[model samples]
Target: MYLEKIDAPQDLRGLTTEQLRALADEIREALLRKLSAHGGHIGPNLGMVEATIALHRVFDSPKDKIIYDVSHQSYVHKMLTGRREAFLDPADYDEVSGYTNPQESEHDHFTIGHTSTSVSLACGLAKARDLRGGSENVIAVIGDGSLSGGEAYEGLSNAGEAGTNLIVVVNDNEMSIAENHGGLYANLRELRESDGKAPCNFFRALGLDYLYVKEGNDIEALTAAFRQVKDTPRPVVVHIRTLKGKGYAPAERQKERFHWGMPFDLATGEPKAAGGGEDYCDLTGRFLLERMRTQPELVAITSGTPAVMGFTPERRREAGRQLVDVGIAEEHAVALASGIAKAGGRPVYGVYSTFIQRCYDQLSQDLCINGNPAVIAVFMGTAAGMNDATHLGFFDIPLLANIPNLVYLAPTCAEEYFAMLDWAIRQREHPVAVRVPGAAVVHRPGPFDTEYGELNRYRVERRGREVAILALGSFHALGEETADRLKTEAGIDATLVNPRYITGLDEELLEELLRDHRAVVTLEDGSLDGGFGEKIARRYGPTPMRVLNYGLRKEFADRYDLGELLRANRLTGEQIAEDVLRIVR
Candidate 1:
């Protein structure tokens, strides 16, 4: 096979157009085979196969730097760059991560997993090359609806103004996770319809030379286009129109569902494993839809990732104008939600913990400072979330909790989560963020308080002397386990407390614990540094109370095993109980 004989981009240099086409076919087959068994980004990788081939054929990677924005489509690039074995062999399927990593190979310039960064990153690389008197082609391949991001524009504007040797390849698939949103996408559609000869081009408007290839999947056309701008002294954009989920029929039909997929059947393209019974995604969607029916002014906002908030395409249609998706722009989403709230409209911005990092300034300056009651539903804010270093969910605690005037709440179960959500939407006080349970959809049968006017009040689940176990949010289950372990193994009845709020401490409850509790153990499912546990430790810094903070350390864990990571951090009930025994003894 052409793929077997070819190892690197240099190998592709000698292959005939016919052979390259054959190789593209083989690469698609390999991608399908691996993606069918091992879940990863499906639509993006499938769409970029030909474009990636044309790229490797035209330029010298590691020398001529090619940066993929978000790098979700870098699987095809990886297969061509001496890592095809990982795709071909099932045993080696787990060898590479879903996103590009510089550690994996010299060919991969950056370890990127987020959106709208390629153009800016490539701009920096191009600037450095010009300064060093090095003449290597610096290419930024950005698409899959990444153009909507504000940074992409910033990068484009910078590159255009620099007039240096930088090539920005816009891979227009006309989709961004969900159907594209924003005015920039309309311009992209115009360019696609007019074959890049549109009078008002987004790229050209930014002062960059532009070329468009309607046949983005055709290797010959793509190669010729790349060759035209290959050592250009000025910045230019090669806008290629490619079909998302190009080869696979099922993927082509359901673009968003196949954007990132689970292990699926190769023939039918159906998921191999059925989804577990209940999940927070669906629950959040259902609840919000019901709420939207009653509240006309209620609006649900998402930063490109609508599914994270359980607003699927059908559900989105149901919600209609009430639901807004600001494509790949978290910063805008935060500010928009703030604006909506400021206008007396109830705005709930549903976002992933990782993505929320982009809106820190907006959360602080735009939302929190003004103290608009914008409900920010934070998904995957736990150690059990996306394990990739670039997409870790454990860091949001430090990022969100420390921000003044922002009240961050952590609910132990679905009942409490919705109750908090309802309250946040209704309340017109401080900016509220609810860290939705990251683990399984934990359902507890009980009445939860809908009103939360009084802040920093921790709920006591169990009263005991000697040892106090303060579990926050997702770690409440672990707190229960520790209490049971303390009872049976250590014969010590430990106090179990659920600290509902992450931003502020329950001073009253904490002060009362000093009377009977010898050691206060704080368990949080996030980084220990500047997290909920650290706040508790700081609260007892001056007092005689001994506070033990249990959580992940301050470090990036890349694609790590959840079990090993938890054990390493001593986050287990067994580990916490043992530590408590030492403190008591």
Candidate 2:
């Protein structure tokens, strides 16, 4: 009732402290109900309920700009900002995104999904306000391990010397995507223990004023702290120590599991559909563990998400020092792996395809230029991966493959993936990146080549004439479907080729295809622009051969249905076959 009555931040201003406490409870209940049925970031939002309520209660939101870093924790902020229906009503569950979006509401300034960007974004807002001679306060709510990012430091350093009105609320949940790592966490721990009284302050050192609120979960404490710095002239960092998953017992017990979860049982806190089947993540973890047994100097590195590599807490424990978590610092992870490989130690950096985009310079200058044999296992590098605009996985091919001296391998199945990984770790020639098949866990029964010293050799699966289907990575299944359609519907036996390497083209195979093939169709589960398909298209540009590149367009698609997205891009088997028939017949 309290939550329903309040539609905006201004409404919360009227509520008494006791009434505000009741609203917080109402918000939590709504969050749990929605999160239980329609799963999203549970722990982060749960932890931020009071802080969000306090923020709304203290600040005039749209007038005074507030930006949330990696806005996964912005659910409660949404609730008070006229978007509560999305959380309270099941019918509207799909209405809002998991992160903050400016399109959704005026209160949500930035459409931030990535971590550690809020401080820099807020600094920009502050600078603009000063330029226009506006008096609105600029607040950057950054924490939940965002401080570990290099950009966060850069923003804080800039904010320090800017001598402008800026408030950075450090929501210290003492966890990143996983447990916090790096030397900065040690300083944070000291600050928390000392209750902001510690002489050695990271914020103060960067020329920013510092304040600490030990009881971050307490609405009154948070409100008081926010009010104190409401109109502060100089930039300041208000470090608040809060529990990650405060309200729910299950989340409190298993913080990481509930940080972001699938639809789960509300009572038992168990997932509705238990994970039983084999996934690419688990397969990668098992294979690496087995290999690490024989190889003493072998190391596995993750920026923040170890689970992406299938390294659970148990698996990470078994690996011990061998498994290193750099803590939300992808740039450092790439450089660190390069250093390890340069020192004659085998380093495998397992990262999500989206996260790896943050380290392109490192991939090019530090790893590829140095030619260190660092094996990077790229997860979710397909059209079917995370559909968020900020976390698009399909773009990695263009980002990584174009870099010189980097062997970007597109594994067709599980067998090929492991083979590539093994070869990448063992070989000391070039920096190799393995794009782990993002679709179903496909098992192809055959011995994949372990030594890939000889690059750009495309394997022909089914030889035929007129049309050559150069299926790269996960799109191999679609290629097979198109070939089947060509044979059944059009009475044509199309050639099916598996292009294992994405970085370079097999000129011999392309030349051979030109002799008989009238049209070459390249099927890749990535962007069409500057991707694997473009290289093939360019190869046959001057010749009589017609090259049709099929993949997602160079645009950000958010929370898209895989089936719908495929159909829109003309990626279906029937569509491809029909196009091929037109070109060939």
Candidate 3:
């Protein structure tokens, strides 16, 4: 009833403190219902309901631009801004995205999925407003985890030096993707414990004004803090201490566990155990941990997603000897690993393929130019064909492949990944990149040599007369399945070729295939333009190759199931088989 009545922030003006608390409960229940039906960033959104409501009550959205860093916590904001009906209906789940989208609402400014970008974005907005002779408050709601990024610090330093009119709200839940790390968290802890009376200041050191709110969930207190800083001429930092998964008991107990989870039981807050186990990330983590033990010089690092890569806190503690979690700072992690490698140490920086885009400069200059021999493990390299354009990992191979002295390796399965990891470790010639496929599917082990150009050739899964399927990474599975379907139903024996290297095209393998096969079908989980397929077209020019490239188009894809995206792209086994049959006839 309370939620239905709240069409806008003004509706909450007349409500008592108890009624406001009741509204928080209502929001939580709504979130639970939505998340149970359609899985999302449940715990983060639930934790921020009160804080978000308080923010809305104080600041006028659209007029006062609020930029949420890693905007997964902006679900409540969407609900308040006339999108609540979508939340109730499961079919309309696609109506509003999990992260902030400017197209969705005027209140939402920038579309930021990456962490620690709000401060810089907010400062730019504030500067633009001033230039246009307009008066609108610029507020950046960044998580405590985001503060660890070098970019956030760069923005803070700039804001301090320029004296811009900006309000930076640091939502201190003491967690990033996992538990917070770095020196800044210590300062936050001190400020929280001292009740905003601490002498030693991090924000003040950068010449910015500072205010700390010990209780972030206290609506009145948070509203009052906003009121105080409404028209402030100088940039200020509002340190708000809050609990992650505040209302939920299980989430609170296992804060890191519930940070970002799948669909779960509302009663116990435990995730439903999907039958199949052993993620590709887990296998990679185990392999890396085992390798690190024997090779003491080996140092493993991650940006912020240690958990996603299967490096839990327990595993980190057990293998704490050479593990380095640089918080949300990808740039620092890349450069630091390069430095370690330069000093005759083996440093492997394991990061999500999407996030690795941030460290392009470091990858090129720091590692590639120097030929540091740093082993870079790029997890989720192909985007699983399920991600939006924002979450695409397709660019990594193309970008890194062009870098001088960088040898890129694309493995078809977990077994090849482990073998490649071992090979990369032993090699001391150049910088090597191991691209891990999306899922862990079993495959028979082949001869894996560390010699740079050896794995570039394609693996022949089946021999055929007329057609050949050129597949990369997990696309090899689709190719094999397509071959099987062709044999059974279509009576077409298509040759399946697994290209292990995206950059170094196996000229020998391709020449052999082109000599024997009539047409070649290229399949990859990346952009169709300038991808592996295009590369093949360029290599063997204007022959009987008749290369039909199957990949993601040059557009921003929406969030969808991986399998569905594959089917949509005609990259599924049945789809590929049907296409092959048509081409053969």
Candidate 4:
């Protein structure tokens, strides 16, 4: 193979057009094979093959720093930079992360996962290079999808006036997670039609010189475009139009489903693993589908990721005029929801907990301060099993619970989740956010009270005496197991309390526990630092109540095992039971 003969970009320097094309084919095959065996961002990687090859050939990589926006499309870049074996060999698949990591190789300039960051990051790198009196091309490759975020616009605004050796390559794949949103995509289409000669160019409007490539996949065209902008005095944008799922037939047909996939069949592009039955994603989607049909004033919103709300493209189409995809703009989604609520519209903005951090100010100021009745469903908010450091779900509680006027609720089961959603929509006083469970999707025929009108209240699930286990949200099951363990092993049936509300303390119920309970065990699925468990611990600190807080320590646990993390944190029922036994013995 041509790939075996090449170790780095320097080796690619001598390659003919034919050889580069063959290398691109090899890279695509490798991407498909690796993704089939171990799931990854296949669509982005497949589309980026030719463009990556062109960039590597045009610039000195380690010398000329190229930062990938979000870095989901950096798989091809990784393969070329002495990491081809990681793709080809089944044994080495786990060796590298799907995203660009500087720890992996010198060619990888930054550890990127989230969107709309590369332009700003590259601007900083360019500024440093200039300050050192060094001359190296600093390139920021941002996707059209990432441009939806306000951060990308801010970066573009800053880079336009940069006046240095920087190239911002806008990879116009015509897709984010879903189809591109907002007026910018219309402008991008205009640019594509004009062949970089558009009158009102977004890039040019920012004062940066602009160049466009009609065939972003054509090796020759991309090579020429990169060469034209190489070592340029001021910042310039090389906007290249490329196919998202370029070579792969299945991926090309269904881009969003293939965006990030589980291990799938290479032959049919079908998921190898069977999906579970009617999880929270499905439940939420069904509920909203009905809600939107009934309530004309109700709007469902997603910031690029429809999967978070279980709004598949089908669901989006079904919701029709009621669904609003604000693209990758989380801040705007929050503010938009706030505005919608303020105008007597019921807006439910479903977002991943990791992404919700982007809109803290909006959540606090726009939604909470005004006290608009907008429902924000925060998914993947647990401490463990998340793949990337940049995308941790545990910290949202600390960031969110502290915010006033935002009543953050945690649902123990699927029924409770829906009930909270129902109550949140009907309420017109506070900004309510529900912390949805991560992996363990438990469902009970809950018929939970649609009566969340009363605030800061907790429900006692399995009441007992001597020891009370206050499990917050998803940890309710763990609390039940702990109570059962205490009964079976220690002859002590501990009280299992489900603290459904996270933002406020159930002071009345908490005070009631002090009578019979000898010790209180607070279990939460987030970090102990500034989390629900610590809040409980602090509440009982001035009292004689012996509070044991079980949760993750304040630290970034990158790609952790669920079982090991639980055991390490003494969060497992057995571990908590053992701790309780020792304390009470």
TM-score of each candidate?
0.99, 0.99, 0.94, 0.98
Select the stronger candidate by TM-score from 2 and 4. 2
> CA shift at 446, candidate 3, in angstroms?
5.3
Worst lDDT 10-window in candidate 2: 438-447
Task: For model 2, state the Cα shift of residue 146 in Å.
Answer: 0.7
- TM-score of candidate 4 relative to the true fold: 0.98
Better of 2 and 4 by lDDT: 2
Q: lDDT at 325 for candidate 4?
A: 94
Question: Residue 90 of model 1: what lDDT?
Answer: 97
Ranking by lDDT: 1, 2, 4, 3
Residues 127-209, candidate 3, lDDT per residue (tens digit)?
99989987888999988489999889998998898786899999988888688889998988888889877898899999899
Query: Alpha-carbon error at 275 in model 4, in Å?
Result: 3.2
TM-score for model 1?
0.99
lDDT of 4 by residue, 425-528 (tens): 99898889998866557887665889787999898888899899988888888888888898999799888888888998899989998888879998888878
**Residue pairs with clashing backbones, model 1:** none
lDDT of 1 at 246: 91
CA lDDT, every prediction?
Answer: 0.92, 0.92, 0.80, 0.88
